[model samples]
Target: MIELREHERKTLLIVERLDGKASVEQVINESGLSDAAVMRAALTLQEKKLVKMKEKKQTIAKLNKEGKLYAERQLPERRILDVLYKMGGEALLSNIPKEVDISSNAVSVALGWLVKKNWAVINQKKGTIALVESLLTQKPKKGADEKLLELLAEKDTVVIEELDKNPQQAVATLKRRKLVETKEKSTYELELTKKGWKLVKKGLEVAEEVTLLTPELIITKKWRETKLRKFDVTASGPAVYPGKVHPLQQIIQRAREIFLEMGFTEIRGPLVETAFWNFDALFQPQDHPAREMMDTFYLA
Candidate 1:
């Protein structure tokens, strides 16, 4: 005769009906309970030694906006391959930009993947790319990357586990293309303990009495028969963070305010300027570390 909360009882019934093992997602769908409620019930059951919760952390891969667009139109590499095939399976590397609709930024990306796939060979001296036998024979086929692209095109998002192909290979390739992002989260699976089975065999019953002493129950003199939920004074409450200005911004603003209060004039510098104006004019040595190409950004 184990006493149970309404939510805990609901969870147990759902799990028992589910053949003693089910994912939190399945329980949520079958039990029609919110995710938080299901998790809370599961936690409570675990504490009572009636059920065990096992967590499997998985990394879910999802396509971004640009990925969706590329999936719809095909990857730049695939398109470039098509362009090369149309040119009799060979073309000057420079001619690809002229023949294909791919952007300048994407040309290198497409070429890199194309060469990496061994679909084409670059002749540095002649600046020409020679396609392999597969492309020339019209027998080259779509691999994991192409399949993933097609799958993503039809769906807004897909977990890596749902893929019918090599998930790791697909995720790795798409990640290099900057087409997908991964997020890791723990997925919980609930299982009944021996005690839980014993309790179930003993016939657990749902408590008909309400836990809250509502105003209606009090007015109707039903509060005497209803069970009031016990409050845990030691339980932690939700954290509170008072909003404030960003730390760096606040510091800059305070510095400006102090300068103004001291009768000082504030000056601004050009964010974008020629090297001569930014360095030479300031008498900064040309060999200074900050003048190195890696240290500064140059607008193209």
Candidate 2:
């Protein structure tokens, strides 16, 4: 006979009803339990040789802040290409900002992308940008990055496994540009073991076992009627990191304590001091190296 905790029993029954195989998400929805609770019970079942758990790696892709912004306003390179086309298919590098609504800081960034995508070429010696001869005869179409951004904007997120070749290839470039972010997540599926099937056939009992003893239970004498769950003391517990003072702060505190013990009074001073008192009063000359910006901290 197998005696199981309520949550463990519920998870096992759901897995059995799911035809001996079900994802953790499916069990979570059907069992009405938190994912953590469900996972804990599933692990316990696995330890008892009642179930086998398998993990699958899934890559999920989504647009970040920059990606979302570019999706709505268009990419910096595409915007520059439009400006170049309007400027008779060429313009001086410095003249790009005047022709486009792009920021001065983003001009260089856009120029780099334009050259990389082969939409435009940079004449470094002439300090000018010119569209590719092929693009001069026809309007340039959207690239893979642009298409992928639009798709992510519409769907919010996409599973990498489901993407077509072009968009899938664009994911790597978009990731490098910080426009998109991808996360690798693990999804678990549970299947009943042979021993699990045998136990199910013989039937099992769900028991409420006490893993903790509280003051209320002791006061009410209810502990006498409840079964105390067996515990394995040798099993490792969750890691604990107790907070302590920072090393620098500890050193400062010890120094203060030593001074106090030596009959020195501790006092607080102004955080901001004028240069007259900070440097001049200390006899530091205007040309003194200590008064240099690199050597001293200054208030903005």
The top-ranked prediction according to lDDT is: 2
Model 1 RMSD in angstroms: 12.8
User: Can you give the lDDT of residue 89 in candidate 1?
Assistant: 86
Alpha-carbon deviation at 240 in model 1, angstroms: 12
Count of clashing pairs, candidate 2: 0
The Cα error of candidate 1 at residue 274, in Å, is 48
How high is the CA lDDT of each candidate model?
A: 0.84, 0.90
Model 1 residue runs over 4 Å out of place are: 161-165, 207-209, 219-300
TM-score for each predicted model, relative to the true structure: 0.71, 0.61
Residue-level lDDT for 120 in candidate 2: 91
